[model samples]
Target: MKKSYCPIDTFINVIKGKRKSTIILHLFQGNKRYNELVKLIPDISERMMSKQLKELETDNLINREVFPEVPPRVEYSLTDLGKEIHPYLKGMFKGGIIFENKIDSEEN
Candidate 1:
């Protein structure tokens, strides 16, 4: 990928899709199958989940491994690149809490 003038915009572009960040955050825990991901994130549809997974795979953020079996076994886990960004994602979680608290206080 070519270097963008705005580094933050470039970073956001990679993870801009719906459910992308959440999906990555989940995979940070460990590998998960398609159904497992669906269960973990109730609001997301199967189609949307599939789409986001493909995009993440394309971006080299996650790995999708398929096994030979009667029913195909597919699992998703973070790639080295993905692992490299895990700390930042965790920091986002902390910032999210702070943002949420501010919103709550404002509404009260």
Candidate 2:
């Protein structure tokens, strides 16, 4: 695979998908089951959610635990690295809100 030269590019690559940051933000609240995450993010399809979760797992930002049960329950939580980046992700979320409000005000 081609390597990214800049640290920012590398970081961005991990969270590039539309739902990645949203997933992280939700996990920041606490560990969640697959269905719970799907419920929290209304617009995302199950297939896309699975894809993003797999990518996040590959990046070491989230942990997936499979329970030994008849139904095979699965839960995801943030890793230490993911916890560390929570503030930055939160900041981006706030900035997005500000940006949207600014644009709305400008249109009036």
- Write candidate 2's Cα lDDT for 1-108 as tens digits: 124898778777878896999999999999999999999999999999999999899888999999999999999999999999889888889999999999999999
Computed on alpha carbons, the lDDT of every model, listed in order, comes to 0.91, 0.91
Which residue ranges in model 1 land beyond 4 Å of their true spot? 1-3
Question: Candidate 2 lDDT (Cα, whole model)?
Answer: 0.91
Q: Candidate 1 has which clashing residue pairs, if any?
A: none
